[model samples]
Target: MLGPASVQDLGRVGQYRFGVGTSGAMDDIALRAGNILLGNDENAAGVEIAFAPFKLRFNADAAFALTGADGGAELNGRLLPPWWRACAHAGDILVLKAMSRGARSYLTVAGGIDVPLVLGSRSTQLRGEFGGFHGRALQPGDILPCDRSESPDDAGELGAEPADIALRQRTLASGARRIRVIIAGEYDRYDEAARQLFWHTDWRVTPQSNRYGYRLEGPPVQPIVPIEKRSHGIVPGVIQIPPNGQPIIQLRDAQTSGGYPKFATVVEADLWRIGQAGLGSRLRFEPISHQEALAAQAEVSVYLERLRASVRLQGEL
Candidate 1:
């Protein structure tokens, strides 16, 4: 079941120069976690549901997992836990209520969505309108075909594990979301004061924000003098300071190249915070060295490894 204003396959990666964005799940960790719990490939195509209430009915017995923002998921009127895997019987209904904490949630079925891959991925590039469940958000009465090899029976009476056997990712607190960044490209060209402001000021994600980029509201950050530049390659994490001074944090669906003055890039590991954050979400940036950035990423990898271990242990129990 697809719900909300922004639902897409996380997005096709590696085809950016062709003007395609890596539009996969905004919170990839959540997507990966759901896949892992259901014993699917981490990159398997799954539903990236934004803030919307939706319902899905199982045509057959299936094993599924919910991860990412706590969406108040209910299966046939019973509340389900986040970041855990469970099985649903034929005729069972799953409903996702409006989210209270995170902006997006991921739902992965046991065999994955089984959507045809476009450009080597099942991600839906909404702008281009290709890939994933007929290349758009699911509508009422639309049926999703699943790979049947891993049905609940095949997995043996499936259900969520005990809390000790399940590993959950860090939860975002209500209010300002703290984000870490690394100063990138043309950092010195900006005046000392402008650079300081970038780090010191608390920014607000405007309502205009979306998968493309987050348009921020804060003090204007201008450089010492106008610098000439040409459009060059850009990535999801690159923070571009436009003429208005408010920085736009490029996200998964951002264009491949931009000419704006590069300010700071959010490190890879912390990008999920932005992904989970909704409009009006508060943001504060803290600078860290290159070494520290790598360490943080490694820590995230360790967390995923631990989650896998926990799942294996549950099987034994």
Candidate 2:
């Protein structure tokens, strides 16, 4: 493992109210797609690989899917394409080389990784260390157990169209990915110029970015007048502007509360795009109405449903 690799599902929902943050797969769509391909539960736990050059050996006959980044994976030396699924025999080695696109890759088996649910989720809480496999990342010699009861018996090699292709989004002329956002409570605190800067600038994802949040590099987005507010509840996708003026996008493992000035929020539908964005990537923000955001979310739902139906049809054949 080159970077953090941990077991994650869709994440704990209701428990977040109890001070536990949701720590699920960053590229949730990828993970869900992998599970769907293998006929596993949509929220089945899978190994989320943040970085590449990862290798694993199956101890038993099984099927698996590789989704998210195209990391040049090879199953026992046979190259596999991104979003592809295939079966493996005992002792088969799966190796993932460097990623060519996106930031993370998900390895989902025929059955989800067998890990005890903590706070109703198997996702790793790196800070709390209470969930996932020991609530930590996978290290060498770490063997993961899988619940193979749901493994499909007649699954042949299957491939899925990547999310980027299946759900295309508009991009800025500068080639920066355009992420849709909705204005937040403190949007009016910033002057028109600051708002324009936030909208027009191609923010660069800094090295400080992680699952906790993404620290963007760009012209400062300071408010018109200094203002202080009490810390309030926050969630993934909330964009907060700190004293230094840089924007921080709270993500999957972000804290439950923060005091930073709210700017805008990346819609849930596009959170996967942010998750897949590699370090140093440029992203442009496009402000949209709340209704538009909901529409975008509906579009994603439709895509997933179509994929699920198609996979089920294939299995029936």
State each candidate's clash count.
5, 0
C-alpha RMSD for every candidate: 3.5, 1.3
Look at candidate 1 and tell me the lDDT of residue 105.
77
lDDT of each: 0.77, 0.90
In model 1, residue pairs whose N, Cα or C atoms come closer than 3 Å (at least 3 residues apart or on different chains), thus clashing, are: 10-23, 10-24, 10-25, 11-23, 11-24
Segments of candidate 2 deviating more than 4 angstroms: 1-3
Question: lDDT tens string, model 2, 214-308?
Answer: 99999998999976889889989999999999999999899999898999999999999998998889999989999999999998889899989
Tell me the spans in candidate 1 whose CA falls farther than 4 Å from its real position: 1-11, 152-175
Model 1 per-residue lDDT tens digits across residues 1-317: 11243334556777866877777877887787787787788887777777668788999988888888778999999998766688888999999987866787788888888878889788776667887776676677878888877654645433333221232334345446668889988889898899889887778888888777899999999988876689888888889998888899998777888899998899988888888778777888888899999988887787888777877776778
What lDDT score is found at residue 313 in candidate 2? 91
